[model samples]
Target chain A: MTESPRVVGRRTDVSGPGLAGAVTDLVADCAPEMDDVLVVPDCHYAFHPSTGMVTNPDVVEALVEALASTTDVTLALPDSQWVEDAPSMLGYDALADRTGVETLALGEADTVERTVRIDDERHTVTVPKPLDEQAVVAVPTLRADPDLAAAMVTVAEAATGSRERSDVVAASAVVDPEFVLLDGTYTFTGAPHKGRFLVAGTDAPAVDRAVAPVAGLKPKAVDYLRPFGVGREAIEGLHAEDLAAELPHEQTDPNGGEQPAVMGAGYRLYAKMTGDLVPPQFSGGSDD
Target chain B: MSDLRVGLLGAGNIGTVHLQSTRGIDGASVVAAADVVPDNRARAEKQGVPRTYEDYTDLLAEEDLDAAIVALPPFLHAEATVAAAEAGCHVFVEKPFARTVEEGQRMLDAAEANDVSLGVDHTIRYQPEVQTLKEQYDAGRIGHVPLASIARINNGPFAAPPARQPVSGWMLDPDATGGGALMDLGVHLFDVLEHFFGELTVEYAHVDASMDLPYEDSALVVVSTEAGTQATVSAGFFQWETPPEITGYFRLEGVADTLRSEDHLPKQFMAHAAKSALENVSKRARGQEPAYFKPTYYYQAHYRALKDFLDAVAAGEEPPVNGAAGLRMVEHVQTAYEMAEGTRAAANAGANVEVTDD
Candidate 1:
């Protein structure tokens, strides 16, 4: 019998103050003794922090400082050859200057090819050098689709260059960070929302399971989280169900916030019957 | 006049709209279409466009077309427009009409040499709110408007939430699209701004990219007309907008009062869609083709602009929004670009001077 992974939680007004203090307290029990800490931020694309599509750069800044209390911190970055220079675009370089953290590209960083087999397939995932040797602190935004703050959770699996179910599972097994922080500052349900909450835990999958329901995502719907086992304990005053009740649920599918074509048609017909124009997006020829 | 034979050049998203819209209008019809993508060409064929081609030049040469809609990428705008003009066809080109003033002029010169009508699809001014704003301002209800501001920001070139169309790479490339948000969105704004305030002079401009793109994704351009009406235009692709709540804020301040686009916009879309759809149903019953996306004023604006251009072609007259008009807006965009470059150079020089002082 395997012991259950530990999951913890924290809540704060993302707008006010003590964000860095909150981060320090939430991650207190997870990781601090390690010499080099690799902080992975949700930066698949350079979406502005205010939109909440990407992880709040401020939160990343705070987490880096907290990690630096004991030792050196390096923010993880994907290679420019693969995707956009997300670190530079998201102003992580500036964040590094302020927090005194170094940014290293995962592809360029020293890596050992580790073969991880999940179910019927095997993948050789290339993880950052520091993670290959030491403890890891990863933060992901809760998108309405999944932290239900998750938007395909591409930031974690971007280095692998595959965005499907198996690829994410493969990477998680290899990197298995000691601490995971879910950024719920701005959540997207059917719309862009100011979702002000933070979650933390040593087990990445356990942390996500506890946080996912708060963002309107069912834990069972996520195939990847099933491997981590069910038990979750909130380290602080944070309840996923209580928060889930407050959010709008126009897009709460565990498969990500993808609305089918038929939904668009039905919505269009509804707007037509009700004597209203469907949103400008459906008509196309909007901007650019 | 007999049906004006129209050839749609580049049957992508908008091309299909044109093909479908052509069926609604009586005096003009899309006879053939061209697109490099097989899916787009097949879509045109499905829309009942008689012939489809892999290249637009083929569509221009083989068919006896009276007019051609140049909906190809901005890089190919000059070449495609020149070919259509030289082929004795009136040309209706899409936005960013040309990459630069030189290219815009070249297309205009070709049209002049060929003696064919050249129209630009500047559709914003046709939106119901915009039309209302123009009428009220012209009627002097606003009383000597001295200042105006407009912003067109959305998740452009990329999808936000309700993802439908995958972004075309050319739209993001500065060289291919001529420019970024300013060229793609600002050109349309400039055309409409000129319509309100005749002949604007570039006052100031600042262009920056938030995303990791070679070109600017956000821009603020300020201009002043001979009448002393100064307008500030904010255009960006950085914004994350949930549809039904897009940020297209346009406002005008005058001595008497203020006017806003939001005030004139259709309220509670559900009710408006019902009425609009019913009207379209009545039109279809009488052999009049039902308007597509009738409730969406933006799409209807496209339909109106295309219809107006076809009317001009059928009547053998210059389009209401012609090639020279397109050229002037292109020049305005170039002037703004030059001003932004100059501003950046001066700021750098100032920093260097401070460094020398130290």
Candidate 2:
């Protein structure tokens, strides 16, 4: 196998008929050898896709359908430290129940502790037994982490092993997923920006490297992704350069909490003077 | 001086808002907070609450406070309020008062038996823009009002951006939340309409469930008051766009002209604040009690409601929005629900019948 895994990229529609096809292509390119696959997707918090905080359920549905064509795929979410009801709280349990796709709450799953070495340091971590599967697919949405280029490694870490932020890279390595699928349909760099693309490869780091530019980050700058050797190229379907050109965009906060005081005051004053309802951004549905 | 000490129950989504709203309010201080979730308790601590409890009953038993804010799920509202009342603490509960009218009555009775004030946070009527429209309507700015309408819509419970606070799963559970939009937002509309036009009779109501969800996600109701004023109210959980795109419309059509809540809203919030601040200063210089709530009325309706309740407590008077008002809103919602059930039953009955060409 190549040190820099062969990465394949394709356009995906979140709601269109093309999702199954794209997801199928990704599974075929990444985990063709495996029969039973454990798929892990980013689901840290109960955040909607519009906010770019968590993965969209549509992406997971497409993946599950695609994998069902050739493999016995079980959707998995590891119950980590922060949330107790991870499966229900993140909404994957409901999706699984709705679609009849068997889901494993990895938090409740039998866990085995193991020692792994990363960057010349040894660490002990607990990962679900499914991480030992011959084919484990690490599927994560494209979003910029304050510390990492993309949240793929962190998602793997969240589902498999340690909660310590620094141990994320080590946990991803320990999980040793055989494939990685990047759900780039909507990437949240700062705010939700549209990429409408998906990519898959055997190398998690190389896949993260490919998606780094899409989320407006340089692969070299992200320290956590350094474990995956550099110089991997993302082979695009149409234009490889177009993906990089679409990146480096800023995500603006919609809540307007951190803005300069004068600007907020001016905005509010304008609304008041004009007898206009405070801007919609400042308005929310009245819930008693 | 933080005289009226208060404790909070259920540090979930709305509880966080209640906790935050207590800050800087005169004569009120949140002394302790309780939540079933440890994470929520931690969050309350972060908000500067000194003590935390896993069970609200424990907090009520231990904390020495004048009142408790019952921001728990609706299923727990009645029981929690009763506990607060028994503990000799006035209870300010989040709306939909209870799961059933009987439960609401029990809560009211508990507060009465204990001689503790019971208030519900029906803050929609306290919104500055809505108040402005109410003022105009009261002053006959739009002539005699015949027809009025109120609507509130949002993406059921989970959509684009999840609620900022940790939303417990109970929000979607019918047993926990009573019904859906009608139970959640309908009570507020009913209360506001009743505030303006007293004693509304639900002439017609229809409800729809967007998905196979357990509860009705939408409600539409037509009502008439004793004065023969007609009003239509609708609430739905299907509002996809929030904040920037307005999802609520409150309007009154009079004989001469129509008045809308939107018209009274300040176009620029910051500009309005500056103007209000200068006006307040002028009033203070003239040795008058300035519009203390002028700045907050624009955005923080909860603060205004809480301030009024706290002031009432300090004065040993009944809260402006008391338990009776809360019960009235619940009664209105129950009637709407009953009407919807009847409609559903009739429609199903029609659907099931076999037509014979005898």
Candidate 3:
């Protein structure tokens, strides 16, 4: 039987107490199983009540520096606006100066194709039509031809300053890929594109699960995913199921299960689909 | 078993500690423990106490006890002590004698009428280091106690439940614990300050009691005594580890000194200047005993207090740390809580609320 693809989910929510350590623990747990990991900057979420506005720029820089030096991983990022706001990107020039990986910016040039440019090298790549407008820049690399892997590796090595050849190898592998990781929050309303299937990366599903109690989403939300075209057919389809199972029942129950009105009739329906109706992992606990 | 039998009321965390302390006293034995909770009775029974009573009244009525340690919740402190006092028992009550000054006054009146020696557990002041500091302050070793500051920040007691628990828990419930860290721990600092500087009024103070719990958790209290001495007392449930440290800084006009001690532990100077002051105090208190001039005081002060109380009971004399002393500490603590409440109300209303001095 074919082994399940070894995937690593990065937790980008950097707000609240002990979250950074939690993310570190999650990454450490996934390290052994992961073939190629995508390390994103610790993202900022505006609505977290506990820590109103947290900026763990140091954490992102640390993660990027550590991933660049130690692991062979595919690092996919959003546009310049998103990248510039990222803590890791502030050190991109220095990282690029040391590592030879080329930093690329992707944007819409016209209806036909998207434009990709290496900031330092001034190198650009333009792909053909029928492209996913919302797919972002990483889509082109995932769909790129096999021969482009060598060129992409050379570019990534120059941009990242990683001496290890495997860093380039993972970067090359993710370029022009078949599957696209989408934000689970927006997937339902967002349109799907041709040739690429939408999947929740390690972080998106976790966030979706984490926010479920607070947001008051129902089983219909997971069932709604297939129809909304955002998530998987069932919550079990997400990779976090095994990890979710291990979390304490108290930590997982949102609203302290005190307000049954919020959970509604969808509770049992979602319970069957998710197997465990709640995100077992807590933001703050002894284990965390 | 026939001599100096002690009846313990409450059987909670502090009550259990009192029972442990009593076990070590030569002349005293805990014969009976009483609590409202069945589990508490079972726990007391496990400690080898022969009798356990569900009602404290029944325990007081049945046992021919010479003394009783009143360790019930703050709101119940007055009632329990008054009951124990009327039963002709010398009472050893926990700190912060009552929830309010009026209640404390009434309880003290009852003890006085009954002619029972009533002592409050002002444990910190009984510490050897604290005693040494008090001796120094009194002997004018530190020149003159100008500005004194006591700071205590602890993660709270081992019995404090996790933060996630409901706000109505015993510790958070004002009716039960009487006002969080300010009442629970601040009383210790107040007792020490009163011991060193006599009676005082709060001149300027700021307290953040409404932060996390329903009761006040943090307080910064500034007091001015009749002699015009100034003292700042700060306490909070903010530390993350055990055996919480209680530290103090005293800035005299001619000299400055610092003193630190943890619960049931040795007291020592953390700064060089404090060392010199402590040495001077030791030399004067214990002349020619140079071994006592080590800039540190070592002794289990709580155990000493327990021993003293036991000795007083045997001799039919008054306990050294009387309930009136505990009442005064509670009065100062209530003022601090009022300060915090006034500040919070003013902040919420977007205007300054005048805090009345009691």
Candidate 4:
């Protein structure tokens, strides 16, 4: 039998203070050298940290602070904009200003196309040039996304070209990170709700396997996690606490399939009927 | 008494809305549409347009249009309007009117020289809740209003995850848009404010960009028509709007009572959608096309604006929102830009900026 992945996590508030000590229990388990590390936060677009739609810059700040104090690890936040300038708009510029760290705009940065095979077909994706030398860390917002673990794992793939789900999965295998940290500070279960859970581990799928139940999803239930063979009884060492039974489970879909499934038929019908250009954030009804 | 043959210049998002709105207009038919994007043109063709053009100039030259809806970008507005007017077609252009006052004036000059009607789509005041607020306030249901603020926020030219397309090239370009959210959205609020209180003056202004884009994503400007009354126009592109929920804050406060946009807004989108869908089915069965955008009042406002303009044109009367109104709104936004720059300069020179002039 293959050894289970060690996954550890903490339940903490939005407070940045002592976050390093709080998260240390899990970081030490990864046993990383913390040298020349590049941090990729799941801030693909410009969303406020408060919305829990993106990674909290405050939490990233604390993580950087703790790393600088204890280790000689050189850290950089490098990313390309998916919709808008994520670093500047998502408060990472302010994070850099406060911490004297720099954000590398990957769009302007030199890139090389990497090929990876997924579903027995080779797909090409562009990644930053510096991935060879840098130890990587991924900070993704924990939510009930369809490809939750895999999306977080391949957050830095194909900035300039077609970035479909297959390209993302194929790219995750190429730029495998040393550690994965999920910010459940406010989890988006169909929409945002306060999950207040921070999950961490070295193996992305394994961590997802262990923490899936906490977020109201089973490991086998996740298609990405299932492929990794990271299902129930997969974890060798784990510490998990979540609002699973209390908070939104699987998705924010308590209505059970009545609502439009995220840009589904209901949205398309509304857009066609109304001639609306802008996509609705949540499609049910007007609050008024 | 024949239907007006119309040509749609841009078949993108708003252009498509205008195209759809034409179905409901009494005597306007969108016969031809033009857009650089094949997808956009295809979308318009799917909406029953018989002909399509890659360049709007081709459409203006080839099609016998009575009126042209210049739904192109801000940079192309003056040129398209001028060409359409020169072609002896009345022009109904989307807002920000033109990139600058000069461009607006140039378009106005061309229209006058060609003897063509010019209409600007400023749909904010047409919103039911805003109209209701104005009606109630004028009736003294809310006594003498001391202060007011109108805000319109949306995620401009951008979307959250699951969106795979590239961001719009011209939206973030200062040269193309003339300004950012301030120009795109503030034009609507400026028009709305003038509808309530005539002859307003800018007191102070500020524009901010959270992203590294060329223009500001958020803008706040203070204005007043009378000596004591304070009104602000807060417009931004930093907001996430779901359908049925246009993120806005329309408030008018009087000595006697307070008026909020929500109090007057259309409610329960899903319920309304179901009702409208059912009604549309019946209307379709009756051998008449049903209204498509009846579910949302904001979208319906877009229809009303076009309908009002077409109705006025058909009567050979001056459109209610004419070239001059669009130019005035453009001038207001330009003043706000200048004032924002001046205010920032004053603050940088070690002088404290006051909140209000009076």
Per-residue alpha-carbon lDDT of candidate 3 for residues B1-358, written as tens digits (9 for 90 to 100): 3569899999876676676567656688999999998877776776668999999999999999889989887778889999999999898887777878888888889988998888888777776656766676677765665677776666443112111222223554577677767788888888777777788786655665322235555778888876556888888764433122334333333255544333324333335225543454455456432221122231245556666777887888877878878888888887776676677778799986566554
Q: DockQ score for model 1, please?
A: 0.19
Go through the candidates in order and give each one's DockQ. 0.19, 0.08, 0.02, 0.19
Q: Native contacts retained by model 4, as a fraction?
A: 0.11
**Docking level for model 4:** incorrect
Candidate 1's chain A scores what TM-score? 0.78
Q: How far out, in Å, is residue B116 in model 3?
A: 1.5
lDDT of 3 by residue, A1-288 (tens): 943333333333333234344334434444333333443321211111111111123333333344445454433332222112222323444444455443433222222323333222322233222122222112111110111111222223222323133333333232332222222211111111121111222332232333232223432343212221232223223333432332222212222223234332332233223221111111011111
lDDT of 2 by residue, A1-288 (tens): 635567888887875578777887777766657778887877765445544456666778888887777778888886534334534655677778767788877777776777777778787767677775446777777766443424445455555544353466766776777777777777766556667788877777777777675665677776776666555356657344686577546643443233344554554454344332232222222111
For model 1 the local lDDT of residue A46 reads 51
For residues B1-358, what per-residue lDDT tens digits would candidate 4 score against the true structure? 8999999999987887788788778788999999999988777776678999999999988999889998888999999999999999989999989999999999999999999899999998888788888889788897888899899998787754343346766776789998899899999999888888777788889998865656888999999875356898999988665556678878988899899998876578667767876676576667666664665446777888888888888899888899999999999999999889988888899989865543
Report chain A TM-scores, every model.
0.78, 0.78, 0.31, 0.75
Model with the higher lDDT, candidate 2 or 3? 2
lDDT for each residue of candidate 1 in A176-268, tens digit (9 for 90 to 100)? 776788777766665556777777766677776676676566677676666554344343566777777766666434422333466557655
User: Clashes in each model (backbone N, CA, C under 3 Å)?
Assistant: 17, 25, 24, 5
TM-score to native of every candidate shown: 0.82, 0.74, 0.51, 0.82
